[model samples]
Target: MVSLTRISEYVAQTANIIGGVLELDVLIVDRSLRIIGDSDLASVSEEECIRKDSILAKVMAEKEQIILSSKEHNAGCASCLQRNLCMVEMIIGIPIFFESKILGSIGIIANTLYDKEKMINNQENYLKFIDRMIELLTNRLKEEQALEEISLLKKRMEVVLDSIDDFLVLVSRDGEILQTNLNFKNIFKRKKPKYLNEVLCADVVDQLLNDSEEVKFKEVKVNKIHDFLLSSKPVIVDQKDHGALLSFKSIKDVAVEMNELYTHSMDVVFDDLVGESPQINMVKERIKQIASSSSTVLIDGETGTGKEVIARLIHNTSTRSNAPFVAINCSAIPEDLMESELFGYEEGAFSGAKKGGKIGKFQLASGGTIFLDEIGEMALHLQSKLLRVLQERQVNKIGGLESTEVDVRILAATNKRLEDLVKQGRFREDLYYRLKVIPITSPPLRERKDDIRLLVDYFISYYASRIGKDINGISDNAMGILMEHPWKGNVRELRNVIEFSINMSTGDMITQTSLPFDLVHPTQEYDEDLNIEVVTQRLIEKALIKYGDSTIAKEMAAKSLGISVATLYRKMKELDLKNSIG
Candidate 1:
């Protein structure tokens, strides 16, 4: 039986399409006697039911077709309570039926009284057209109901099999998959297959189907790293083999169960992140919210700002922390070899390919996190391929026929501005949206100057212990100089400065004298009133003091100052510093 709701939905869908076909307005009344669909954008509400004396109500009660023309109706119009109020010039309402039971009706209305008179004069042709349309709607409703039933049955079986312990798949005698569970789909990385060989190897299918004797359980390697115990048994129906039931249990899962006694520890924690700034704190909170979900993350920050460190921290705090963490630098790799390096290559993919083929960073990072640094450097052509892999959750190796499905989490970082790249048409806009699902920007050092003192003290102690120096702390003058520097290279540059000062220190405390010459004798703006020679002399003196007596250093200093080493040496000699250097 066709449901009233289903019949109403079919009417609404057909409303607009049928207007051009019949060149007349159409209205649908479902079994509930409610006006369901109207093509003319009519004033009547779809929720309203037909009144008892309306022409439509009488036709539905009588289970017959009624034609209303400009002229009076034969008998129905006499009894219709709405005859006075109904402005409809002409209408044809016919009862739709299924298995001899009245279901609903379709009504086609004429545009004007003249049109109504003309339609009534050629009533037979209009009836035939209306009858044909009703027949099509009835058949379509039956087909939709049948499909709905099949879908419900499939969902019920999936739920039942998914609750079972083992990974299960049912196949027909001809090696067609009859049913499979989510675990089976996830483990094999395949969907419902028409042929068993689509999900399993051809050899495995042939062996299982052809063997008449009891099939013994066997160990088989499914992917590169996982091994599973596979077994098949005949599904009997009335003493005849109908199909086979296949099941598997992974060896690694069993090992993990037994090793549950061992303690597992994460590689990173909130404490490992040094800064107490609000910006860093807010970032940590965001990581906590999104880390568990399997969404792609984009880390945006300048170079040497520890983007990879954020990636690692997110992975360590995630559920997949037990798995490996693999990283690839997109800008570091050569353009020609990038595809093969990222997606892997089959053996002999190219002349110098590795023997037995190599797994890509994506495949290696399965069940873990893969960090793609400098993702903005990926080429446009490769960006399209990467988008496909992310969409399908599968990778096709270079020179390889089969595609492998991966369960890896993606964490990408870039020093470049990707949105600007998108506007420049150098990056794929779709791929940009895909990677920035959870965008995080590491704070630059200049913006978070409050953390500088803590970072400086930490690095001083860190490098001091590493270099076996007795340096206990930084002097007030050295600390003052550090706070004033621009720190163009961020934290990484700060660490380098501390390391250099520690090596040059001659006392327990790091002082101004032990600092690099560039820091100790930093450049200062000269007075505008000074003469050209005075300004020139002052610039020469700073360079000579910074580079000292080293020829290579002086040469580099002179070149940076846009002068020749000979000129710098002459100036130093004129200043009476030549003998002081010797």
Candidate 2:
């Protein structure tokens, strides 16, 4: 049984390729005698399908490979002149095939050179390959159509079984278990079987079905059966009742049932993000401004600083929130497959490519956000092609003749310093400018001590629910230790530490003892803290001497030093530098 869809599609494509090679139209049809695939540039009509003079119909009826020529067929058949006027006017000859037994016929119409034996051999090989495919498709269709009918029958049987207090089972005439709903497994402590091999109805009545007195069908297995009052009825579909279907549930039973249930939740939201300090606030504000615009965003940050999360937030908050937010880890994707993963490839494009071809991430994320995480790891050669896509807004698949127009918003993230990369001539400077139209940096956890309390409390609650425990908040000492520690891995590391402590701690409050060994243990502090007043005075004096005193503002000096202006002003006051202020 060759799959009609695939066979028809291939036949159509081959017809076109052969048609192009020889100059003609191509058509493919299925067994229901309907045209399923057509490669003709000219339009076709539905009624043209049943025309007796058509090459496809002749191929199906004759059960042989064919090459139909307009010159010969129209002159021979009476009904063919009209068909010639309607179809195959330009077709000098086309290959039509009857590939398999019981599988639908495929007719490829082409005005091409006739190499009949070779073309027929190709069709036979294709048919053999698609035999299993057609069977699977046909079986799936049968199951789908039967689903609704079977579901209704099961519901009707539920009431009859509810009246009984014990397990019930119904086996077939051949002693094969045909139907078992969720109830029998629960009541009798029987695992719902993957398949029923030799279970019969009579065996079930004697062994599993409770209340022999309640049984209404006298024979248990009858030639022609109908409904019996307050008892199971024969399940029917399209006037034919399938094997016995019985339903029974128990009020109390333990089957030791367990399943690995999984839930996929998008737990990361913009509000879950920590950081209110000014250094981070400026970046957040800039992200907010740029998120609304359709410009390409390049997020630069150190590893584990939540670049991907920030990228997600921008996508979730933007105008395209309803559309897909597809993320591709550029570094993780293999270099050899990266091209196909981005631009997709056509059927028979390369060895091992799927027959019908694949749709790429770009096509999948059309009109949505595509997050290219770890983009600095993208290959240099691919970077040039990527730049072309950003500029062109379209992509051509591998071996595909046409380009598909895409309107995808790019939001690329990287932990690598791209500016340094561009300066070193590793990354294209043009692409850098294209992506850096808006850049957002997530402040590392150590940079914002004030927000540590909020983050700790959040993680405490989060981890508690996750591990199925309810613990009290962190103590002041634990909080102090947390704030004192430098978070190299940022918030991600902090969350892990909290989770570990919560798992280890039995008491309500997270004490210093419960904290990880690294944090709980003390280390020597940096002894030589620089003189703030002297350092700021010298810095501001130097800047003012060159740029002029009035031009060099307190805010400018503080920013240049990568320190707080408040700290700088405090230093200015201590050094008597305010006396020189306007």
Candidate 3:
């Protein structure tokens, strides 16, 4: 191994091995750029050899190995007529290395008398081929080492699971308790279980065996002392009947773990919401109240208000916390595919349908909450379908004849006023009433202006960690501007503004300069934003004065505007001008 460090020794040692099987002379070289070693042979002498002079020197200089096949091409071999009788038709050579880092060269010189057929067939001439063999051996060694390390890890994990106080049970296919790390022996103390056939409880194992071979298993709701909490996963591998892994844990511990996972998985949390005013506190209180309820919830807020955050908070605090809480924006879905997305169709239900059918939002959230965002944007047609499902407590697939009973609790959030929509014939009044059963409204960020500092500080630290920098907090001047801004886009807008500020921040502080140009210099034209009532009053007064106190003014106003006289009368009543003369 030490000698092989230089190319010269490696070539000599390798050549010696080949020489034992075949008649050939060989030489090796080290990167010393010197002749470290060589095979002392009969057809070659140290004094007559082309070693130190320049043959190997040229190979090193060019970063490539040299091959001399015929004595005719070599002036040195040409003089020695033994070349014509040489065995090799031509010598083949290649460079040697590991991971692109070159080591050295290995070469064999055969007499013209050597076997012609065998020389061409043997890869013994290419030094790179030998390097490849070394690599394969290295990989195999690594794989074996990895397998050993994994075995050690599994053993250590087993020990750790055993040390915990919870009921950690690992079961097998034949109804055997392969391993029980929990205090099951002390808790149950069963001579047998109530079901019998229960191997853990010896007496019940016989009855369970009568059912036949165990193909599948489930580990659910196993308790330690009582129902603190637990996470169980069945070992479903490659169609094999492995058992399950059941664990016992506290509810608080699960929450902590989930919070940890959120830090790693989700970029933002409830803290990213910008609001601290009493109105915002009221929204939080409503959310807290809604969290404990198992009934349907309807969250109403303006477009920019954070309805999505309220839904997330509800999900996080609810009884179905372990199940997935999926959100689907009804407005974002394309009309044609919306039905299939909500109530999945079987394969071939449509040309592009997937095999074995698809699971819809309700099925995906079987035991969880489904938040339908922008619910009012759903077509007037789908509203009826949704209403049917809500009323019957079931959903039928797009093409399926049978209905699936889903235990999902619905949470529909919308910015649009459904009550107004119902009156305009854009939404069904019956469906609107059903959805508005437990209404909760989120106030706009401007209304909750007090939350500005809390949100800004949260975002600064949040984005700082995300960007791997230290943006300590928002500056006092920056905070004041943030509080004063009208935040028309509400919490969503505030998040964007804060994110923009943090991105522009330097030396651990954010300032006004970081704000977008439009935000700093708003270009709102006051003329375009006309007061509806003032416009109506001016038109009314002019019409009344022009027509000389006639009732025709109201009729003319309604007719010209393409509205009913009754609607115009209602508007006048609202403005206290129902039957007034100019």
Worst 10 residues of 3 by lDDT: 215-224
Ordered from best to worst lDDT, the candidate numbers read 1, 3, 2
In candidate 2, which residue ranges exceed 4 Å CA deviation? 1-264, 522-582
lDDT of model number 3 = 0.62
- Looking at candidate 1, the ten consecutive residues that score lowest on lDDT are 257-266
Q: Which lDDT values do the candidates have, in the order given?
A: 0.76, 0.61, 0.62
lDDT of 1 by residue, 1-582 (tens): 575557566667666556667677887777777877778755557578765556666677789987766437545556667668766788788887877888777777886877687677777887787787777777887887889899999888789889877788788889888877788777656434567776556666787787633454454445444556577788888988777998876644543332233223325677656687887877788889987888999999877777877888898889887776777889999988889888888766889986546567676677777889999999998898889888999988889888878888899999876765785688899999999999998887877888888888888888999999998898999889888887768888888889999999999998998889987676756745478767777776666554544667689769867898888877777777655531
- Write model 3 residue lDDT over 102-138, tens digit each, in one string: 4444455554545434455574544444455335433
Candidate number achieving the greatest TM-score relative to the actual structure? 3
The true-versus-predicted C-alpha distance at residue 410 of model 3, in Å, is: 0.4
- Could you tell me the lDDT of residue 429 within candidate 1? 97
User: Given candidate 1, what's the lDDT at residue 24?
Assistant: 76
Clash number by candidate, in order:
0, 10, 21
